[model samples]
Target: MSEFADRIRPHAPTRDDASARRWIYVPYDRLTDATGPLTEQPASQTGIVMMEALAKAHRRPYHKKKLALILASQRHFALKQARRGIKIIYEFTPGIFADGLEQATRHHRLSALTMMQPAEREMSLDVEEARVRGIPLQLVEDTTWCSTESDFDSVFAPTTKHFLMDRFYRRMRQKTGILMQPNGEPIGGKYSYDAENRRPYRGQPPVPERPRFHPDSITQEALHLVAREFPSHFGTLDGFDLPVTQAQADEAWSFALEHLLPHFGPFEDAMAHNEPDLFHSRLSALINISRLLPRRLIDDVARAAHSERIPLASAEGFIRQILGWREFMRHLHRRTDGYRQLPGQRNNSSSDDPYAGAEPSALNAHRPLPAAFWGRRSGLHCLDTVIDQVWREGWSHHITRLMVLSNLSTLLGVSPRALTDWFWIAYIDAYDWVVEPNVLGMSTFADNGLTATKPYVSGAAYIHRMSDYCGHCRYNPRKATGDASCPFTSLYWSFLDRNADNLSSNPRMSMPYVTLRKKPASELNELRKRAAQAIEELCHAQQASPQE
Candidate 1:
């Protein structure tokens, strides 16, 4: 055992009389005091139960950096609590989360436990099961989000098939008053600055370096632990630079305000060949893991914009992500019963695999997710670069995620469940609350417009216009049939042609369908042949991959 683990493992307080103490269970993500159960009870009267489930960590090929970040952050949080005189029952145990909870409860004599509602569906179910077994658990509201379930229910009916982000965002703006005027209208007379935020970067103003936090002794221990435990997981363990404490997270936020936010809007959608994090705030992992609270970050960003420290587009763009999309994902996850209520769940499937027997996507996509996603080079510069970035960092900007990864997956007819599983396994910021709604509902249109108005699929032309990867790619963006043709271009037309019946009626997709119809049948035949060749190559690559 490591010296740190040896020193810290036996710190659980011993008490002859344990029934008087009430305990709080802290999940891996919910590590902040802003919404933590500690606010509901005192440290003297309340103990803390912290668990690290080895089996759960190994359930999927999670990013190695993600595992290290979570482990380090949880350890830091527990250490902070221990210093505050809180009795901590920290378990680095085997099996699932519930198993660890059971061991802690049994050994520590915890009769009644209090905890915040977890951000993921499986943990929530585990908590429910514990309650069903008469554990006397007091479940508190998850206060991490700016809006509550009631807020979502107020604007959207229970039977509402589609959840509009703009409407929900407006409600949150009015509720939080982040970018609102005194008259209750949105500041600058607009709720969205999305149109103004889509400029391609020509490298006029050079991108600044993001602040990196070198691992401390505690973080080093966590890194070693993850390396020892999850050696086979995806992503590199080297270059672990994320913030593990609130102070460090605040420092990163301050750095973003000064250096990154100025160009974050204009370059928000822009992707460069080697620049993986161009002007985008690397705060999603910190925010999702609760090192930084959303409300404070949103308020600070608004204040910065209002004071002319940053442009309105940048502030509104950043705020829209946190105040708009982030909260929408959470609420929609809960509303949709956190993937349990998603169509096509099998009766025999385990809770660990929510989408195991999921039906074919709306477009009837059934091909396996290609091995290219697991770090194999597809010979396409855009796909290869983004995959390599994810392999190294466990992250990529949203544009790369939506337009490149998900777009290609959609066009290539990769199975929605397979793609969703890849996303959940690969991303550092992914959780059921965030990853499921984004993958199934928005990115791939697997939920068939339940959370999105239209599919986010795009052709090579869009990729070429938005990124420099096309310039370096061997494939031609203009061609759609020959061996030199871009897969995105060829498959995009094939996708539209293949799913015209299902998508042609969508108001947003009418023009695309018209364009698809304008193409000659001879050229459409060639495009399908090219798409078939690409899928065949992907099948060969996946078959050769050991991980697949």
Candidate 2:
């Protein structure tokens, strides 16, 4: 695996906490959005940062790069606390998540602690951990985002089962009154304006340039340290944007609100060939870790949209992203068997060991996580191209994750274990909670249609329609008949053709499949052949290269 993580392991205290007195407990942060000025700093240092530095020095540059980014970013946050005179400790756990209070209390020997995280499940885990560990825990409000837990939950009671985002979102519109009519109804008598949200950028060469914050001295030192430590991972330190302080994070948030939030709605779902960050908020990693708050970001954008300063469609779109998808995902992970092995997926049922599986589990088919996909015989480049792309860019718009990369992995019949493992390795924003749902549930269809209704599959034409990638692409979207035809084109048609026996009858897909089935059989046969060839070429190229 990754040398950055492998070389650095968590240090267990040799002596028990029976003698300790003075301490400040700081939880691990995957997304520093939780650690605003309000939360107490974690009182220890987990040496993942130094390990990342060493790995960068000794390992292959790709492996080093990705690991370095995570460690550097985390290290930057840790340094921020030190300058404030907080007695911070960074514990180097195998995982970056300090997820529950029990883990924090037990691991750090804490008598009392304060956290400013907004995710309820994580808070619930902390509470239970505190109860079991006999430590006092306070759920301090996080100021990084615009909204608060109380504000969001004010729309809820402890035992309500019928709550959905639409109602909650309406409350948001009313509370913020962003797009309200002068008479007090939402402007246009409706709060959600999603209809105008998905237009393809149908214009000329006028894409806005992303503002680059060239690595500052602090970021540069962290980058050099990471590169020197973890040399075998992925990514480049060239565009590292780790906001060490809340003020910096706020500044980054302001840039997004003032410049990107308006057009965020229409082009949010749109993805082109290589433009992964297109109008999308690159704030997830920051938000996830407590560097910024989603509520305030939501409020600011919502107020702007409501006041007609930003378009209603844009504001509504942004709100949906924060309220609808992000929060729903958090609750879903906690409430359901999301972290547990369900039905027939695994054996161990205890929630503590998330991967311990369900009931009398099946063979750990998912465990040894077949590296053959990485061995180059798998033909899809799931490990190489996809990993490379994700490492270089901390975030890839959802469509790229779902359509091109994830779709190829599914169609290539690569195991979900391998696909998700790659996601775990690559994304800067990945954590067990968020990454698992998108990877296993949405991309790999490992959840068996829980997170998404069906697998997202596409060939070239669709990818071409959404962005400018096709214009510079080596393959042709229109050519289903020859080598010039994108492998995606034929593969897409062929996948639908092959899966038609199962997918065609499904109500949601009948419309598309019916149209596809009418195409000439000869055309489809040719398309399948091209896809296979393309797959073979990709496999050969990746494997022959020294990187894999």
Candidate 3:
């Protein structure tokens, strides 16, 4: 027997017992029939273990809506399974997940506790520890993903130094035959429609109203539970409309197809003052929780485009997010172990200058995350508006996340670790698997060129063009200095100036470097001073935060 096999002793069979009692442990996120031991094991013989692990939920200051959605989903799934005559051992334990699992396993005297492989690395390690501690824990394959590990390996191997997302996306397209012609060409004669998808929304095509799901009894109970337990947690559950069951998720998906799909591609990158869900599918929370599978959604989108019900750009754009970015991020996070070991190893230049060849995490960005992130008021209209939306809904589209939250954080030199944790805690769709690769690699360039070729840092001009935030703001987007200068504008120039030596070598950054080289020393010094003041003001706001 292997060392792992030997450590996890199987439950001894009794003379009177024909077979050992086996249980399938279901986590909060894995609430579907798509993957895990639930698929392989016979329902008649297998018992189910569902836990409401309060200790685990309280580890971070998670948003209340996120907490309610997860707990409510788990409870509803358990009830559905029980109604089908499956034996469910539901444990509402106040301990951590591992503690609850071990206690339940021992109390039941099960032969083995089978589970789907956890999405987060910490939970995976916890499972390994349980096995080593003599618990008969077995992990089955996680089949919720549309692409397999083999598909990822075909594009980029373990030893491959450079990896492109487009190449990986193409491999998945060929493997799945999605949006591909009979002759194996892309349907639109192009692999990506990202270039054509950047048009800003200008109030022409009226944004449709999304359907709201009234809270069912189970969901109401879950919300009450969250309210009583985590009252101090960030975000309110007053307007929580997230789907808690497969049926509700299906309804939401259908609504997205009818209303959001046609205009999703064109205005995907745009941000408006009060429109938080402008043409966004808003299916990420449901999809991430496995209430809806990625494969089915992609198939539906391809069919819609083929029938000309929705434009090819809209279908392809949405499909790429699932087949291209979502799958890519999952595999990358799995390979890198949440990017804990990726930093400082990629750029190890022996230089006195800190950012001479530093990776994203090593860019010496030691500033703290500001109080505005937690719904505290900031003087800037863009930050305040986006943060308020996120606080209310537990969501924002990708562009708002990348350009507004992560962009400004990067320019202000906030710690990557802080930003990563905040993303995981604040957003309903964010998990360790998705949030780390995005915040560390793509958003912050912490992985240096692992996921993104160039740092996504931008001046206020990009925001001004992409959003209507500047028009309503008190500060001037064009100014890089003085009291009324836009913080994004000032910090952007300061960020470029601070890291000129490190980024100037890259061909993609040549344009910005050329502009930086032309700027006189006096103007550069003044910009740096303005950036320092902005950082100081943010720190003051953080110290004065209500939550603090």
Candidate 4:
């Protein structure tokens, strides 16, 4: 019934078949059990050190509650696999986990080992290492996500056309034939009801709810271990109701259906200052784990929509998160194969600049950006300020994350690496596949032309259009050119001017830059002065923060 049974069905090595059975073991953070190779491979705990070092670099303990969440999850998976009659050995390494995989094989007498594709850097490292050693290796489909690699590659390989999400989405519909009629046609004369999904709550609609679950003994034990081991972590564990088992995860998913899915489509991108869970189905963590599969999740959502148990938009949106975005990320990450080296991936690209030279490179790679890249806890410092706040909450709406944090990161040149890693470490929902592409490629432009046709760089006006943040903040989102001017206004112009050779030559940016140049001389001078002054204040602020 499980993917493991299928992979090793006829080839399973038993005592009758061989005198000794050894394997390469990987403990997944999401799945309940540990997995091993039917072949020979060595294993270690280096992933623990990398996890610990990441926290230490950020001045948070390796045992911090957030870090603890991952460690606890992985540890539990290892134990589960062991109970199910699999071999697992743990080791510690500071660099990539794949290096440990390689080392384990070298040290062992076994022929070769099997492993899962790691969540971050070192996927290729493991595969290549296996090849170099002339050892047989098995690459398994990560059952955590529903789509297989072949599914995405096949869909993408057909035409020489540029990838469009909508096209792939349509094909997925035809293949699964979800919400379609028996005649192989779509329901309601349309495949998408996106237009009906976008209503800003005027407080008139009934307030939808998120499923609430009490942690059972297993999750409770994990919570206690996290608190005890990482006393200095950033988040509070008082409200620890995270789903840890498949049954519990199913309950959590069902709860999303009953309480949240109806409204998810409309407010999916909306954000409120203190509202962390606005019409969101927060099952990414479990989805990343093996307890749930995206295909099944998508199928369930389609059923809900066809049955009219939920609105089409809400169901469609949910499916996109699981089926579209999550699946695309896996393929993108695997295809890129340049995860760690990408600019600003593990650290801010800004940190590599001379001004940020003395900053700890490793720290910058993994930790949040220095607060100074923003304002004095005031204006230009929006992304850092917003992210620091989010670290405590472990959640925020998509708009808040993108428009406020990701947009600000791009405008501030926070560097793709640092921003991407921050998104990866801070969000409970983050996995390498999703976080890297969104943060590195979409948010920060670290991956160049990988995901987006262009970087999503924007200023305060976009923020104001989407949310109420501008009204509550001190900076003037409107005033374009002076000390009182919103930092985004001047900084935005400055970015365009500075990168004109790189940006304006483009076909898409010509109009916006032309518009900026149309400003009067006096206004342009004011914009320059305001932007420069803001940078100075920011530099001073960075100098004042405590270093790790």
Per-model TM-score versus the true fold: 0.95, 0.71, 0.92, 0.74
Model 4: residues >4 Å from true position, as ranges?
1-26, 30-63, 74-119, 123-137, 155-163, 179-199, 204-239, 339-376, 379-385, 505-511, 543-548
Q: Per-residue lDDT tens digits of candidate 2, residues 214-286?
A: 6555556557766665444545555665554566678778888877777788887676544556677677776
Q: For each candidate in turn, give its C-alpha RMSD to the true structure in angstroms.
A: 2.3, 7.6, 6.4, 7.9
C-alpha lDDT (0 to 100) for residue 41 of candidate 2: 27
Off by over 4 Å in 2: 1-24, 30-85, 90-110, 113-187, 202-205, 239-242, 272-276, 339-389, 539-548
Sorted by lDDT, highest first, which candidate order results? 1, 3, 4, 2
- Candidate 1: give its CA RMSD in angstroms: 2.3
Instruction: Return the top candidate by lDDT.
Output: 1
As for model 4, its CA RMSD to the true structure in angstroms is 7.9
Best by TM-score: 1
Error of 2 at 289 (Å): 1.1
Q: How accurate is candidate 2 locally (lDDT)?
A: 0.55
lDDT of 1 by residue, 143-193 (tens): 887888899999998778778899999999998888899899999999999
Candidates 2 and 3, the one with greater lDDT: 3
Q: Which has the higher TM-score value, candidate number 3 or candidate number 4?
A: 3
Candidate with more favorable, higher lDDT: 1 or 3: 1
Question: How much is the lDDT of residue 195 in candidate 1?
Answer: 96
| Predicted candidate 3 versus true structure: per-residue lDDT over 1-548, tens digit per residue | 32212221232223222134457888887888656567665665556777888887887778889999998888788777765545666676898677777787777676677888787665776677678778888887788888778888888877875567899999999888999999999998999999989987778698888888888877888898899998888777988888888788889999999889989998889998867678889889888888988999999989999999889999999999999999999988777656754533643333554212222474777678888887667788888998888788788999999999999999988988778888877888988889888888889976767788888989889999998899999999988799998989889888888887778888999998899889999988888899999988885553523145
Q: How much is the lDDT of residue 127 in candidate 1? A: 77
Tens-digit lDDT track of model 4 for 1-548:
42323332333333332224445445444353332232223222111111112222233222134554555455455444444555444444453444555555544444545556555443444456556756566656555555566777777763322344555566666777776689888777777766776555444355555555575444555566567655554445666556655556788888887777877888776654444466787777666655566777788888888888888878877886666666777666665543433333343223432212111121122324546422225444345446555555465666667777776556555656666655655567665567766776656655544455655767677766655556667777888766666777787787677667666766777788899889888877877787777665643354322112
Which candidate, 1 or 4, has the higher TM-score? 1
